[model samples]
Target: MPASDSDAPARAPWWTKAVVYQVYPRSFADSDGDGVGDLGGIRSKLDYLADLGVDAVWLSPVYPSPQHDNGYDISDYQEIEPVFGSLAEFDLLLAEAHERGIKIVMDLVVNHTSDEHAWFQESRSSLTNPKRDWYWWRKPQADGSAPNGWGSAFSGPAWTLDDTTGEYYLHLFAKQQPDLNWENPEVRQAVYSMMNWWLDRGVDGFRMDVINFIAKRVELVDGPAAATGGGSPMGPQIHDFLQEMHREVFEGRRGEHLTVGEMPGVSTDDALLFTDPARHEVDMIFQFEHVGLDQGEHKFDVLPRNLPALKQSLSRWQDGLAATGWNSLYLNNHDQPRLVSRFGNDTTYRYESATLWALVLHLHRGTPYIYQGEEIGMTNVRFDFIHDYRDLESLNHYREAVEDFDLDPGTVLAGVQTMGRDNARTPMQWDASPQAGFTTGTPWLAVNPNSADINVAADLSTERSIFRFYQSLIELRHESEVVALGDFALLEPDHEALYAFTRTLGDETLLVVANASDAPLSGPLPADVSGAELVLANYPADPDAAAHPTETTLRPWEARLYRL
Candidate 1:
């Protein structure tokens, strides 16, 4: 470990104050001319992460796959995909990262596997095959309809009929990715074995993908007429399966490993059960209550931002898990759009709003994750053509909406431009070069047109860079106990333009105030903040207000942190 690991006094779990950076490998960096990011590219960026002060790197899947879901549909669990390099390179990346005092957390996607996987192939090869029971295989009704009214998350029916076998297999996602039958003990053991194999290779933890969806309704109940698709992700046996997985994969290695489940429909009540230490399910959960606020009935149906509801949702999680469970605070990842563009103002007050958002999230009581390109204030992409998108979800939606349902192309394009996954997957901007210094060869996806202004090189050269603000936030979390483990109180929870909160630990208290809108905001102080010292201020202190720097009044997109 690096000398800075022990800089702070002892704490129980190492991750509470630690920040984890998420790397969507394919868009992070490209070492070879293949125009795709690989393990070697990640190895070259270790120093940059070390300087940024993140304690861990949560990598999206790099396993052998057909790239149908961009590496989510794994065909082989034990080896790396050829485009992303080999197992030897993966091992080297792990060794090099640990040398810089950074832990590696691999994405664990056990809920499903590619149709080309050996198990799936054998399962579908014959109805009476030994591995036939490894997947959900159901017979059609008398009229030759699907098992039920269930629909696939990608578009149509969840059951894709195998022409040769004459039986339908359940695929909650793209037909190429089939959901595994966890009811089979063999399947559970296989997943456990694969996880242990990775652990032995020195991985620090896992970011489980849709982990709650592994256990589904065994009865296969019929769905509503509308067919809301993908069935209930939080099944009846979710807790039982999670406990069994913990015992098999991380029982004795407890505090040494971190497990964060990405559960979409999880409630605060259910999150408590998943993250409570006594339950042995996981270390934390990535809940979607806050992120889903801006989306309409459909994920791509973008809507205007709602600040009050966002405050209520996040505050509930902070207070709900206050005593027993933990939280994972993140605004962007491989599957979500850029944070600044989605929630914060990205055009006029780009730098100010970006830093303000960081201040509000990092001060909360959770383990924060910084997605790739986020430190440099990256924005969503605006592609002129629909064919330029590479995300499976976006492409599928556009096709179904236009060709089949006869929807207007302009409306559909507008939705995806505001709320698309590809907006977050563009190649990382390294410099102001024509290619943004991401690759010498053409990129797998088009670079953002505004990359020249938002690249890492320009941000680092500026005095008031978002990168420097993020670096300070990480340092504060590592050094201040109040910011990490203190009791949280959301003040002015219903305020329209002002977001206020406080963290108290023993005799020390930390206050955070932010103006989330573009206009100036004035409000009464939540506490006496009169004598508090201004620890952080994004805007220069006005000469007249210098004598009283802790005032609750703020400029457009201004955020201030005070300590008393």
Candidate 2:
């Protein structure tokens, strides 16, 4: 029995004990031999997700789109893309997910809409249109420059001039995705109505994409914040909008629905405001501070790994939100490269590193999100040429670097190979088949060549399987209060090779020690864990060592858990 089991309340939010699995639909599984993965493919994998022991499945956008931003540029919010299926198929998928005791979370991308969306089309149709105010529109400067100096996240200026309207519009991302005008009350209500529609249809909640960028400061209307450019317009009105959204869409249904905002430039203090229960904004947020530790000037400008920097960033969030707010823990996602290849070893120490990283992540105080291919140790891809990449960010940046400037092609390609988003978009490795069992037809993206060895069938056949390890971790979270409600504290804070932490709730203390490097090392045990009980370890536990539990030696990429 868990030591703090009695202290935990029976009616705590379902999300507090939940484990969310993110399924990038385009690459998760392909059905009907269409090359593109669809709702049916996800439906076919419901059993696999349930068997994996996830509490909720978060599906990336599948709305009707032009496929410019891979469904993020939604043409119709209420309908599924033809390639993915229809609204009826979505309803069936939702019903099936609920039948297996798993909740479904839809990605909400209200920050922008596809330029082809009816709303944007009407807004851009003519200046006299009723929906003209639905989007941010501005005239060019006297010098015929863009409305402001803001740059696009996908590369280039944030403002795009419409040929017919002779006016510029704001787009924080790709030009095809235009920013919505949240200053308009009608726009807010429209978004709220759409959200309520999804919740009413049995969808559990939303994982909002760039939700924080919805409310821009008034300064972004005509000019830059300073000479350096407006810089991803975030302002005070964001909380007001979120609170109003909660009151409108999720007011009556508390504790049943989950809302996790994916805020890119949010700070710890600001995250507390957004997630505080009293604020009534959101349940948790996905902050980018920890993920940006390895990034140099920009995300693609990757730097060598720094264990201490990563530890500090994660610990800051853990401690900052310990009292009021909540955190969403994730190492990689649809927009990120595979964690095993980026942070840990994907070659010689693959299994050890993968399970060790999983153990470290799950033991953290926040709710852990497992990306689809993480459990089996799927890794980053190595596409030799730039044309093999599909993400707009990679392609656009490569073009700007090579054609616009005279940078070496090989140097730029190295960044794409190391940290490009395409690495995570590879087809899921279900088996050792030619297609990696993801599809009967050619996959939309190439299957990572190493899938034959690092796949579900191969891993499950091994004596120590990563899938089984993740299953145990999920079960542990469901059963232990110390894991769900514990206060976190970092140990060996400055250590370069070892990562250690402790979680404490009431009189219960759980310690985790991980050797992140590929070298045998010894460190002193924390004083409180002198006679700790060895609860779990990636490697075999020695009976003699387990008796006293004072030794602090670890193998390459080793991890251990103890109860003190």
Candidate 3:
């Protein structure tokens, strides 16, 4: 079993030294051959993660739901969905993970619940109902329209009218998920109880979804619509409620439990309030500033972003969080397209590009998160039609393009193909078998067409596969104390084609160099220091290349990690 932190010193938190592996359960491996991954399938893969040297596994939501929001809209948190597994299966999976020194962190999506949730069902029954205050509800406008122009994250008005109750309920996402009213003391107590209940059941921690959206703008001001007429101002009162929540529930949580917040629109300055160790509100906040750097006028537009722009944003996050709060470094997740295709040349140098990007992000001064199938260098799915999309966000954007903006359906569908979450939700590729080794039946989402060439079974046999490179990188992070908690400094900020940084802890120093461009770039070492050991290189060890003494020559998309 994993060493119990209960018996360890209080100062050394397990998460601080841990590498987090994110498992989008459905896209991870399908052990039942049903084309959809489940808890048992994840249970079977614990050994793979253990061998890869990951310390924790952050499982996406698996709660009972209508699948309206892909399990984010939960009807029941206390029970596992039949599609995934039974409650007993979850316990067994947890135990199995612990046995391999891998901690499991469940995704806590308390910001909203499925309209099918008992709480929402009761709240929507009647205005005078006992549970009416559980969710945000407002009276209709004089014209019988929405209460305000506030927009949903998925695209339309945030308020959903219920003719039965003569009120409109707020939902930042799909109308199927009504936002819970954190203003209600009863609701706050209920959420706290739920958190305690899960922690008591042996979960290592939680990955809170849209945590900042828990508290809304009490005044309910009408937000200015986006140029696309879909923008919504994220509420102002969010911080206050989060502070209160921390004091009441998270202040004295048992065992060094980790808490990572999905707080979009959080500026670097505001991020400090939630992430500062002294405040203890959250261990880290997933700042989306870097991810959206390349986004176009529309949310789903797959516009190209400049490499310099990406480097600048990444540097800003590193510098801003250097002393305030920690960062949860990641390139892809359930919400993003595959990094290999999005930022790198996934077709030509897929494995090389994936390794280079991983080296650039993982070696930074923060806890790294690896999405499932990413280590094998997964690429995005290609769809010829909009109907192929499983994500609500993509569908909403496509509708806007076709119905409102009058854009060509083909163009809109092509954009969705590039940026849709369905690209990331494809079934995990185990082998070049029937159903891409995902399942015997048709999967909820289709597997990537290129899975045959990049399945785990094939990569495991290849010495130079992206998966093996990731394994080496992860092992290096765990064994080197300096890499885990070193001070980070960006080197050659103006180097247009190079993303280089130095991580140092006292006299122990490690330099990470990446040729961000597609073309070869040769340059002098960041410093005049010597005796640098070619500890780990994405390419062959370049003794002759280093023999030149002063300058370093890096091949196209080359990446290297050196210890001095």
TM-scores for every predicted model? 0.96, 0.97, 0.94
Q: Scored by CA lDDT, what does every candidate get? A: 0.87, 0.88, 0.81
Best by lDDT: 2
Looking at model 2, the pairs that clash are none
lDDT of 1: 0.87
Order of candidate numbers by TM-score, starting with the best: 2, 1, 3
* Tens digits of per-residue lDDT for model 3, 220-334: 5333331122333446666666677677766766666778999888888888778877765788888788788777876676567677777777878777877656778999999
lDDT of 1 at 391: 91
Better structure of 1 and 2 per lDDT = 2
Question: How displaced is residue 485 in candidate 3, in Å?
Answer: 1.7
Tell me the tens digit of each residue's lDDT in model 2 across 358-403.
Answer: 9999999888999989988899999999999998899999999999
> What overall lDDT, based on C-alpha atoms, would model 3 receive against the true structure?
0.81
Per TM-score, the best of the predicted structures is 2
Angstrom error of the Cα, residue 349, model 3: value is 1.0
Q: Model 1: residues >4 Å from true position, as ranges?
A: 1-11, 221-231, 547-552
Regarding lDDT, does 1 or 3 come out ahead?
1
Q: Can you write out model 1's per-residue Cα lDDT over 516-551, one digit (the tens) per residue?
A: 999987656676666678898788874534555444
Question: Of models 2 and 3, which has the larger lDDT?
Answer: 2
